[model samples]
Target: MIILHNYFHTFPEFPPECEFKYAPENVSRFTEAMLSGNLRIIILSLFSFLGHYGVSIFVFVSGYGLSKCYDHSGESKWYIILRRAIQLWKWLVPMALLLILDRYSGYTHFTYAYLGNNKIWTDMLFMLTFTANGLADRFIIAGPWWYFGMAFLLYVIYALFLRKSSDKVLWGIIAGVWTLLIVLSSLGLDNWVFAFRYNSIGWLPVFCVGILLSRHPVYISWRWISLGVVLFVLSLFNRYLWVVSPILALFPVAAVLPLARKEPLQNVLLFMGKLSAALFVTHAFVRQQVLAHDQALPPEISGLLYLLLCIVVAWVYRLCLTCFYKKIHL
Candidate 1:
């Protein structure tokens, strides 16, 4: 077993010397062009196409990081899981409260008259109970809340497996779950209402791959990365392999990790990683409000604006939380 001490640092970081500092000489025409709002919108829109894979990547990273940090220091597995859940809850609770306020204050329309009983209340219960992903329908308000539920479930699975199972056993279990999900999807059970269509069952294998990587941090060769690229291109034409596309994308990313040790890249990546949860929870609401108010705005521009607004709002929310905590201490 390769035990890496301080393996999973809290946030992605690089050597201090590699940090981001503006250099006048390094400013290029492309960089200047990126400063323009319209150009930025176009560029961001292109990147946004990759957004569907974000949650899958997050689960993979979480599994890898948690596994790397796992210690056999005699602490109870339940205690570790609870601690992580509390940490996650600290961020989630604030967003949940804001959503509730929006729902009740007529700022957001969560209820549809067509649905006889209020589904919003059911959504709220699911959100609070960390089971929101069980609601497979996309019409519900706060649709992104499903990620939290799915992630929470994955965390519990990771904790349990890490505590009790051997690496081979864990791999076998992940393979079993993956095969079952594929079988169900093949039988058109993905459309079944009672089934956990949006659940982590489909994602567990990806997460397990991450855990395996943590145990054996193999250097991904250029050949593998090239193969991954080919697979990704092939996936575009073959819809059946779409589920594993994120895993293929991750191969190139893993290969590039070493090159990204520079400070500027690290800073940007760290900021995004830190605010990812907040942005995920808040972006849908921001998008809805923006589109509702400005129906004429192009979808690309609206998406760019939504992203910028989410970053600013999430930053302010974190600032407010810091102040509140400071006041409590006083």
Candidate 2:
């Protein structure tokens, strides 16, 4: 809400075709300052951070969960692959329905462009087959969904390479590649050399780090604390340059996460973790439909509405998932 209010006059973050316009650039700072005189500035920044911070956590959780899944399923690799493929359909169908609504409603929003397209089939194939990360290195760059695609690809690569290879050699190669991508991205050479696909590559190491940690949980504790400090410093100063931050982001997890996998915390984490996917996909829609409005509600009021809507949507999604899981006996 602070971010939106900051740009309410101009909507400068979006392309020109977008419905909103920016206020004049010369206005010193955006607040209800010379206008409504009702809202506080600190609140907006807090909400914006909330909107952004959950993503990295989601990625970390995903890597950890996938490693556990592979370990526990004990089924053939092909069977595990097929199971994920089926899960993709559960999401793809809802996404399809949303796309149809956006297209038919003639909404010319950025979200519309991101989600509605013929390439959805291609995207789904990439998603279901876990080829998105490598394929996205060559093609699409839509939104947060790219992370899912990259995760899919990372899993495939791990299965094909590290699963059968010697652990020492596998971790060495993964770490080497992950570090290289981070250095290149941070140096601003990612676009020219890797066409900015370094970000996707960066995440590969984290996902593997999770896998490796799952294989040997005890070594992670102290390492996580030490590396976490460095990653925290980097996060404060550096924006993720196309995938490079994956190394920094994964370091703490590689070092410390085994401690988190213990009983009660594990159960809580698992429950919330299951909602991460549905939350990621649905959060944007909830924000748009319930939070954003054709007319401005005061920023504080709007922020409250937005937060409330997200909580409701998340709850509803949890209920729906629970019912669906029960039906399928998952």
Candidate 3:
């Protein structure tokens, strides 16, 4: 069995106490590119191959990092969950305000086209309740919000597992959930199960892998890295196999962790990581309102510009938050 204990130790934990802290050095460039929508640098079709699977990798890392922190901390589970929700709200509030502006200013049609017809208030409920995946079709303004909801729910579940169950029981429960998802997928219920973001139990295995690795980290070896690459390649040929792709992708990511320690690359990753949450929340709006309406520019240029705007906007939002918090302290 491949051990990942040492790998987890080298990287920073997730849901970091400070949003601007240095990112986990092991984070894959492919993962970062997907979040930042910075695809122009990727020359191969690998970008398309990894598409949504990139999000799976992110989810896995989040679970691993959060579990690591939770295990080390003595705080109550409810308190940790509440803190996570509040952290998310800090990012969400500004985006929510922007969405409201988009609605009154007639940019609503763009989102409606992508997300289907749904009331904004209903979508907000889904977002707030962490049920966006279950009601994804109704999330007209921010389909990506499903990720946040699903991840938060996972955090809650993981916390409960840690609090109430032994590690062995937790493993058994994860295995049962994973097997059930596979059986359901084989029975043609995959669509329904996947519709509810929390029910994408295919990813639960990935999350479990993360949790296990955190508790019992193994040394990073070339053999493991090779296996991960093989699995990632296999996942490309079959969609059903994509469920494990994130776990496999981590091998190559781990292999590169050392290089990420260097000066410029480290700085770049930190900068991107700091803005990742904001970029993720604001990129869709920028694409819909700015890139989509600009017919004069080529799609590639528009995409590049859209990503740039997301970075600028996210930076400004963080700056404002910092100033506000400072003022409050004063």
Measured by lDDT, the strongest candidate is 3
lDDT of 3 by residue, 63-123 (tens): 7788778877899988988988888887777667656555667544543244434477677
How do the residues 217-275 of candidate 2 rate in per-residue lDDT, one tens digit apiece?
75446656676657653453344432335445455544546766888888866765666
**Which 10-residue window in model 3 sums to the lowest lDDT?**
1-10
lDDT, residue 223, candidate 3: 85
Candidate 3 error regions (>4 Å): 1-44, 105-118, 136-138, 196-200, 295-298
The TM-score measured for candidate 3 stands at 0.77
Each prediction's number of clashing residue pairs: 1, 13, 4
- Evaluate all candidate structures by whole-model CA lDDT and list the values in order: 0.58, 0.51, 0.59
How does residue 36 of candidate 2 score in lDDT? 39
Give candidate 1 misplaced runs (Cα > 4 Å). Answer: 1-49, 106-117, 192-197, 255-259
TM-score of each: 0.76, 0.64, 0.77
User: Measured by C-alpha RMSD in angstroms, how accurate is candidate 3?
Assistant: 10.0
Tens digits of lDDT, candidate 1, 165-231? 5789768866686566556546656454124436766677778888888887887678888888888
Q: Candidate 1, after superposition: displacement of residue 191 in Å?
A: 1.7
What's model 3's overall lDDT?
0.59
Clashing pairs in 1: 18-263
Model 1: per-residue Cα lDDT at residue 105: 68
